[model samples]
Target: MAGHTHRQLAVLRAAAAGHVEMTCSREPHLYVDGLACCDPTLGHQLAGLLAPEPAAPRGPGLRVPAVLTAAGQAALAPSAAA
Candidate 1:
């Protein structure tokens, strides 16, 4: 696995703990603890780390909690801790 930036790793950690929230869109937005993440790149990076959640069919503005994939959890492992 490629090394992740500090910010990317932070997002992964938050996602693993279910502390991240995300919007389903072309350019998804991510929030950590109800505060928006200003870094747009984090959202793109998380695309690979997080597994897609089964979203309910609802209105346009739906924000779902984020979940990490196995790879993401691996990235946060002690050896891979960045």
Candidate 2:
């Protein structure tokens, strides 16, 4: 099961709340346009959290595509799940 840490999830959620868009590079690295409020650690954390399982092999380092799921968007909303 792929899972993210609470902090990582929080960053992702926050990003969505701020209307920041995320995308994955060809190298499979997640990038956020309005993530100035979030630190590198938070980004790394989010990447790790949303990363695929080890068996799947998502590439090098802790970088991956930054596409958030519907549940992730919902979680980012302050009025939604925290």
Q: Give the lowest summed-lDDT range of ten residues in model 1.
A: 51-60
Q: State the local distance difference test value for candidate 1.
A: 0.76
Residues 1-82, candidate 1, lDDT per residue (tens digit)?
3568888887888888778888877667899999999897678867767754656443345677778877787888887743
Residue 64 deviation, candidate 1, in Å?
0.2
Model 1, residue pairs in steric clash: none
Q: What is the TM-score of each candidate against the true structure?
A: 0.79, 0.32
Scored by lDDT, the top model is 1
Task: Judge candidate 2 against the unseen true structure and give its global Cα lDDT, from 0 to 1.
Answer: 0.46
Against the unseen true structure, what C-alpha lDDT does each candidate score? 0.76, 0.46
- What RMSD does each model have against the real structure? 2.5, 8.1
Q: How far in Å is the alpha carbon of 77 misplaced in model 2?
A: 9.6
Q: In candidate 1, how many Å is residue 73 off?
A: 1.2
The residue-level lDDT of candidate 2 at 79 comes to 63
